[model samples]
Target: MASSSSPPEEQYGTESTDNYETTCWGCGLRVMLPSGASIFKCGWCGAITNQNKKKREQKCFGWRVLRDRCFLSSVIIFMLFVIFGGVWAVYPIVFSISLLWGIFHSIITTILSIATVSFFSLAAFRCAGTPPNILWGSYPTVGQGDLENYTFCLYCSKPKSPRAHHCRSCGKCILDMDHHCPFIGNCVGAANHYSFVCFLISAVLSTIYVSIMSVYASLHIWPSLSYSLGRLKGMTGRDLAWRLMNEILIAFLRSTLFLSSRGLLLAYLFIASVSLQIGLSVLLWQQLSFIYQGKTYLSNLSSHADNEEEKKDCQNLVRFFGFQHPVSRFFSNFRVTQKRHDT
Candidate 1:
């Protein structure tokens, strides 16, 4: 453990020409600092020490876990409802339309359902990346620059790497943490980040497919709507548009009164899927854009705080997906190597 010169006054001490000594957490050696300097970097091991950082009590930790569990349960239930309810309501109409079409749609639904659920489970249930264990606190074991930019995690009582962030909800430090998602009941860190992105993609696609199918099913079962043609005859420009929209709205409202149980369910599914699709599409776009900039959500926020410019490059995206270079470049290099070998 690092030792401060003055346990209480070191943090609140006044500035002076004098100097004080504090122990570095990395090398466990005393380091001298100017008076009133609350933050300093160790010259020996390059570890950063911030006197202002203090551990806070994790109040209501159980309550946070409970809240996350509740949210997770709600998400699971909603997914189940969408899957079973949509199938029950939409399948009959789809089958009635054409045998081959029904089978094709069933296959699509199976694929989307499997993909969405698998990705979701991987993202939610898997560990969200723990920081690697390293030897510290001893001068003999720790070497120069071994703990560069490292800070002591008061809660974990351990050295936290620069890339790690403490997640109160997770009760631990997560390496490359993006954010803690209540819906997933987990942190979006290095281990689960790929899964989380995949889940978002699959979810968005599933919602789009569900919305389209729901609309298609509704079209087959929708009750006839009565609209007056006289309303459009005397209208033009904005007036025409407003009048047309109003008439359609009125007709749809009136037709809904005659909708069967299946039609009503189809309408609900369509609305839900479209809403989820829009929200999830935006989230996916934001995630991809951050990846393209070689940043995670948390890192992006930190960069904004530090007024750092983002490095936007396609190579970041390629590296994130585990590619060293573009496929064309990779193949070109391979071909050149093959030619050299032949010669």
Candidate 2:
């Protein structure tokens, strides 16, 4: 007998109501509900079932993969060009300055190049934290709450953890996914997030160094500015600023006509490095801010949707860097000893 007042969708058990029987993916048990019911959780195994969700055919999967590969290859080629081109073009001027100075810059360049490339490789090639496999699909094997807050991943044909997000481009579910970076041809997630951050830091430093060295080299070889500033000697403030900029621009254009191939390359490298520096610095700042707020880029968006308050704390940064437990344990021991003595 069915209760008259109970909602048809809320009813459970194997007996069908208007042929609305469905099987639980977790427990592999038949359950009955109304035809309108599209979402439900198994009472026995607590596995969420969403009848509305289905595997989506990715039509542009190949195109996305190709795009990522192209971007990654371009980035690698650009990096190699910068390294070899800068060495060839700038080293002559540097060595001319002094042997000690040249040697010092060589060491710095080697260290920066090694560090930047290493971190970039690690971040790009590493697996971005796959979710651990769990027992499911049978009531006997799957205990209650074993797959708590888990949902069926139609794409993976498996249970997806609450913390995980499916990256369509990566063709997999990534645990604690931040975002997919086409430049690296990888998803930024739990496993590679730190490496990605380190790469950004290293890349920024390398760019700064490259910009400085490019400027040094260019200044040493640049032709003297033929500025006709005798008419504007008495100009002050904004007028002086505008006139000075105009004269510098004219001088630069005139000097470019006489620049050697190496000088031109140094100028190009300086502009490219400065542009990259600004972009990478902004990205690094954004990543650190998200880390300090104890949220990933996706989670931050979800939190905003849910109207949840962000827990902004320095401890989040410390914990993220994996130093919380040891530091807390060291302080806890002294606190425990002091409390024992007081007692």
Candidate 3:
């Protein structure tokens, strides 16, 4: 058992009868002392530890997690992609270029995403358990001294977990806690970290694909609408085509009512709108799918409280990936504190 404060009687030193023996958590040095030994003086390495008990206790943030105003604006851009992209896809008929455009954009975006996620994932993993103050170098935190500890979480309390921080947002210690992105709308923790990367890969591609498709669909619609108007004015098919394609202007006086006998460009409109709509629909649904699964910015690492759920999530994730590494079980957990350090 770890020593706690000695009883009131042992304020300074009691009688010689009150001695207890315990192993040092700091350096494994066996220490024999009074019942009230609150601190351990390690003879081997000269490290001071909370000898009273068995062991003692101990933001890569601010760069990426932007202001609410900037963040909310980014969310708006994504929303517009959904709304307009859907309308455009489901409408008119477009050329084969739409296919190439979507595919090309998706692939390029996916590559970029892969690069980004890879960098952060590897960096955070390497840096886990390192305090942010040391990680970021000297900076003003809300300007608290014991607040030095505020830079890094006490990891359930590990020496340091780089990129790891106590997410007041998450209200738990997180491993490799990157900014909780509300856009994808999830905290980027170690457990769901890969998934967040995957989401970024898929999402950027999906959005770009929808964008090109939306543009193509819109192109087909308005031009066809113009073509129909020309045809309604009793222009010949060839003439109407030229006018709609902006090649020629066919002016014809129908009845004074100005009702043009333009046929509906139903084919182009229907096809383009449908295609754009389908792509957008998929993108939006998948984003929600990611969030619903609780797979977003960070991989959802199980916390101390998530004993059952975290265990399940960890097992499921590891199994799904088919990795059999044992280090996952032992190294992933955080200790409440590290042994106190001395100069």
lDDT of 3 by residue, 200-282 (tens): 55544544544565455544443331223534376777876666655333322122124321112223333444564566467
Per-residue CA lDDT of candidate 1, range 189-220, in tens?
Answer: 99999999999999999999999999988998
TM-score of each: 0.86, 0.85, 0.31
Each prediction's Cα RMSD? 5.4, 5.2, 19.4
Measured with C-alpha atoms, the lDDT of residue 207 in candidate 1 is 95
State the C-alpha lDDT per candidate: 0.87, 0.87, 0.43
The residue pairs that clash in candidate 1, if any, are: none
Residues 215-297 of candidate 2 have per-residue lDDT tens digits of: 99999999888998996889999999999999989998999999999999999999999999999999999999999988888
Off by over 4 Å in 1: 1-17, 228-244, 303-310, 330-343
Q: What is the clash count of model 3? A: 44
| Model 1 worst lDDT window (10 residues) | 1-10
Best by TM-score: 1
